[model samples]
Target: MRDVSTLVSKTDELTYKVPVGLKRVPWIETLLLSSEPSIRSIEDTVKLEKAFHDASLFAVKEGYRRLAALNVPAVRPGDFLAETLRDDRTMAKVKAKLADEAARIKAVEDRKRVQAEKKFAKKGANKQQKKKFQQTPEDDDLKNLKTLEQRKDGGYSGKAPKSKAPKSKAPQSKGGRGPGGPKGGKGTKRSDGGKGGVRKSLFKKTSGGGKSSRGKASGRRFKAFFLA
Candidate 1:
């Protein structure tokens, strides 16, 4: 095995040579001339990004100084003269994806709101129905009182009341020989005589052979009876 002490002594004795008067090279120029090295790890990618940022800062400072010395304009003539890293078509696709994501989020929110409203609305409807059908204590008491009062007054029976039979009136009698008198009374004789008399009167009044005279006689008799 190698001795640890000897290895340590050799490392301590080693010396690095430093070059003098070497040409200075800027990171911006080096990056512009060649493609960046492929990153192998996360740390390497972060270091590359930091280097690119530093190069951009250096370019901005150098470009301003160089353009001022050359008496040239530094700002572009138009905003569109500046180029973007991503093309217009790629940017358009990114915007479309963003819009789809926003729409989907909005639709989900609307659906949740509608469901919550429906849930609350059903509870409200059920509450209203319960209130409508529920009987109050005051109303129940009033109804009971009314029923008791009716029973006390003998006004209400459990079943419908039976209808009473109409009373039959006795035939009126003016005297002992009136309409309701003896069966063989003078009133019967008078009635039998009046029928023949009424027929004879109608025939005698209609002897002119026109219906107008007969109708007039009947009308007059009815009018006299009504007045009496």
Candidate 2:
């Protein structure tokens, strides 16, 4: 009699653990213990789905060992003779099952090959994109400086209008009151006769210039009178 108090472990898939005694038992005996009438699929019904179909495959795979050990010929329904003594119609069905397994293997291999090719193609396209980016006119050192400026000014896009106008021909003027400037000319012109306009009155006594007031009165003196 079965021990009704024994705790059985239930798997998440709804299959319970085979009892300790049942575990690793000959697959043929396991099938005999099952209550299923036959092993056939309406729509690819699984072992767990069809109630004891697992026992059938297990037994089918171990057909010779089970029957020889049983010492009885007609004890099991899915016998070695059941498949072997079949007509031409059954043979065709069995070969077709073999073909399905072959097709499934080939499909998996083809899918892997396609994925690998696509991955390598994408890598090559990435390299080409980087090369094209490096070759653009925007990659010039001076152009890049302008791009940096534009980015600092909050331009998210790198695009900028090109300046086609000719560069300025005139010299860049110096800042802060140039010497001999618009406001005052040098003293050289007044005394020593350098180019351009009259001297600044402030620097008129500079070297190599004509006489100042101190030199103008060199031979002159003033007379003084006194009374007793």
Q: What is the TM-score of each predicted model, taking all chains together? A: 0.32, 0.29
* Clashes per model (N, Cα, C within 3 A): 0, 0
Q: Which one wins on lDDT?
A: 1
TM match of model 2 to true structure: 0.29
* lDDT values, one for every candidate: 0.60, 0.54
| Model 2 lDDT, residue 4, Cα | 42
Candidate 1 regions exceeding 4 Å error are: 1-82, 132-228
Over 1-228, each residue of candidate 1 has an lDDT whose tens digit, in order, gives: 979999988887763323357455433333233223534555553355446657666766776676677676778447552475657786677667667767999999999999999999999999999997897999889988888789789897775457798998644323224334563233323434442222233334455666566667778667544432
Candidate 1 scores a C-alpha RMSD against the true structure in Å of: 16.9
Model 2, residue 58: displacement in angstroms? 3.8
- lDDT at 108 for candidate 2? 100
Q: Where does candidate 1 clash, by residue pair?
A: none
- What is the Å distance of residue 158 in model 1 from its true position? 26
